[model samples]
Target: MNNRLKSVISAAAIAVGLCFAPVQAADLPHVVILATGGTIAGTGATSTTTVGYTAAKLGVDKMIESVPELQKVAEVRGEQVAQIASESMTNEVWLKLAKRINQLLAQKDVDGIVVTHGTDTIEETAYFLDLVVKSKKPVVVVGSMRPSTAISADGPINLYNAVILAGSKEAVGKGVLVALNDQINAAREVTKSNTSTADTFRTPELGFLGYMQDNKAHFYRMSTRKNTADTEFDVSKLSSLPRVDIVYGYANMDRVAMDADIGAGAQGIVQAGVGDGSVAAQMMPAFRDARQKGVIVVRSSRVGNGIVARNGEANDDKEDFVVSDTLNAQKARILLMLALTKTHDTQAIQRMFYTY
Candidate 1:
């Protein structure tokens, strides 16, 4: 065979190989894993010791590599956003995470996002993302009760399922989802019920969006609340979120916490009031003064589940306070912060509680 003839045959072979390529990037949905330090990456001194372990021992690359099954569902990429326990989570980190998510989801090539976070504050981060992420692409936040070194570390399976959910077209517009223990929960409803358990994340009032069965997500209901693409929140230009604090109510609770929070320049305060969202007689004066200082006072029940009813008996009508509709204290704080960004009117804030 002459040199020219040999080259011609090689070109034909190359064309044939290109046509038979195993997997094309365009054919696969691109899924990015934004890993923040949590129990999912934690290291235990012994397999039996679940608590008192070192968290964030593993990085995003190792986490993705450990879950080989993830590749079977979608092409996974990872970026370690933070390596600290969620207890150390700050407003700075929240902004960074939301900004990164918005950046990625804006890309035409990216299909979905999966965030690995600590179970302690995963619900907060999920709710923030649900409100701020402007895309219809799926965003799944996942965490584990056990560290990576545990006997039956729940991180791998949770992560695999999260990737599966993120890459699915059906998951779009369902808002940010918390996937763990084979369950799918909307960010607005889910909460950390148990301190140390795989099934800790639960939505007491509004049950889970669906469950993970047969290693696949089976969604039963979609959230009706405004979220994701429906929400007006955009964190792309947010340098810092307005300060909001929660005041837990108790039997003998005084207004010390509320006073201190207002003194510290809290733009909004969520009163984790006692049953039925009633403020103690002693705390009323301080709350009134807070509302006088232009601080948005929102009423939410400390008790889990159930919506804090609007008007009636709580003096909400007279005091002009906002009521959190089905949102707990922490979640109410999240909503109030976003609401303050848009408006300061109590009526407007109340409508936000109702609609969002």
Candidate 2:
């Protein structure tokens, strides 16, 4: 055939192939679901089965099966990274999960990612992912208040909303978020507020970032917190973190526990202090000693809603401790642990506390 005739035939063939090729659904977005076992994956025989049943039973496939509508919202794929209770989650587990999220977000075809986690420590994991996973695509962490076997099980709806939030364009570049009870919360500010209520997770200070309605997610506020993903610290550079412990303060508190944790080689300590983040008079010396010995000390209020004071208390100020502004005790612990991985300098760590 002549060269011009051959070109005409090739163009016709290409046009025919384009017409036959599959097109993505009109409203659907490409979403990757990373399932790490939590209450959402737990199974129980009774209504009060919060602590009575097997965990990690649902896995990713079964979770997607329970929420078939997710398929309509996004081209969903599942990968089970772990199947442990949220309480059993550790720094190593977080590192593995962050790495997986990084890999998924790197894919051009993946528009977003959703994580199924247990409510017990979901906030911690969510915050950890927010800090470390460097992705412009949305990263949503979700869990249910009740297990699948319980009456009025909330996992299906929560999962459905999670997929919708993950697939939404508004979610992009919003840092990591936790979608639960129809509320979209910033990872840095959200925390588990109740044990049994469906509305368990909340962002006390800044309120929710947004919410899900009519199969779509709506946003009213944006997160301003700086994160590891947006910082100089790289996730790949983190391997293992130094030991960190949460020390609670109460009347007649024993100093032995603080000493014990420090003696046990804890590299970081978070003090869940009384109102205004006050450490007990007796525990002050032990905290100072720990700080002097090179352990990073962070003061966080157990009050749940207010900032821990930094300069008013003489002893606390003298210890050169970092104060968590408005972050609850547990969240402060997670931040301290992550910050320690990057630097042990108290000043730099303090800046992290203020910023993230």
Candidate 3:
């Protein structure tokens, strides 16, 4: 029991204990972040200037490094899908992202996915994945209203919460989720409501599925919408989605917009109409004519909430037009575009609005 023997025994014991200790980071779920540029990746002249900023200026590597807390929750990896404002996000990009997600999820190493998208169209992208992604693994879409350089920027924390949700067992089979502003919104239920605030996204009709507290996902409810593996639509084989446009209906709005969309080769048009999804007096003729010419017309409310009843004042039944249940115009447009990829039947399309 000399000093040298005592030191050797202590070193051996310490090495044995180290071998038994669990490596927390290595044991966590693996999440892949697909970064599509938005305010989250934006850069401004300074922290005080928020009105006009250059978005998608940062790449995936820089963004992943910004939130160090992400390492504690999951084994995160970053992939740059595109670096463009959400408004510039196109259908071609959607197909590419969806296909890539499917490919990644097929790997044994991937447990979930987190998509960093521009807030402008995050809902559309999330819902599209809900319909087409045929997996039970969690897919959380996240975005921020303020640029990364803004004062009190919400990007870092939002991205952190998104990673938390993607790693959570509670998020599986729950459709494509939208994680932002401490709220967990189902893709089918959430919409962006404000142009400049952290709390821009809201679920007006159905409300959020849950909220994040203490850096974890707290599930309160779940959506019954047909999404993820339950959805009938598939974008895997689709090379491109048909051209669908939105036509806003107002007090004196004319058929000019609808006519123009038809001229632009719109295969489907989402009419953001008045109360109860009613088509304006002057626009009904154009809608009917478009329906005759193989253009699918979907009546959705601009009022933000409530269902657009089938066969209601919009004359959806007689006009052979479809109705969007509670989908806002943007979401309605996404669904219509995906639905057209499957079938052209009016009843089938109507069923899509009701079920999805």
Candidate 2, position 346, lDDT: 88
lDDT of each: 0.90, 0.85, 0.90
Residues 1-356, candidate 1: write the lDDT tens digits: 99999999999999999999787656777899999999999999999989999988899999999988777678889999999999899888999999999899999889999999999999998998888998999999999999999999999999998998998887988999999999999998999999897789888867899998776789999889989889888778889989999999899899888889888989999988888788888888998999899999999998887878888538787999999988899989998998888999999889889988
What residue runs in model 3 are displaced by over 4 Å at the alpha carbon? 1-22
Please give the ranking of all candidate structures by TM-score, highest first, separated by commas.
3, 1, 2
Candidate 3 on 225-275: residue-level lDDT in tens?
A: 778888887777889999999998788888887898899999999988889
lDDT, residue 326, model 3: 88
RMSD of 3: 3.6
Instruction: Give the count of colliding residue pairs in each prediction.
Output: 0, 0, 0
Each prediction's RMSD over C-alphas, in Å, is: 4.8, 5.2, 3.6
> Considering only N, C-alpha and C atoms within 3 Å, which residue pairs clash in candidate 1?
none
Model 3 residue 43 distance off true place after TM-score fit, in angstroms: 1.1
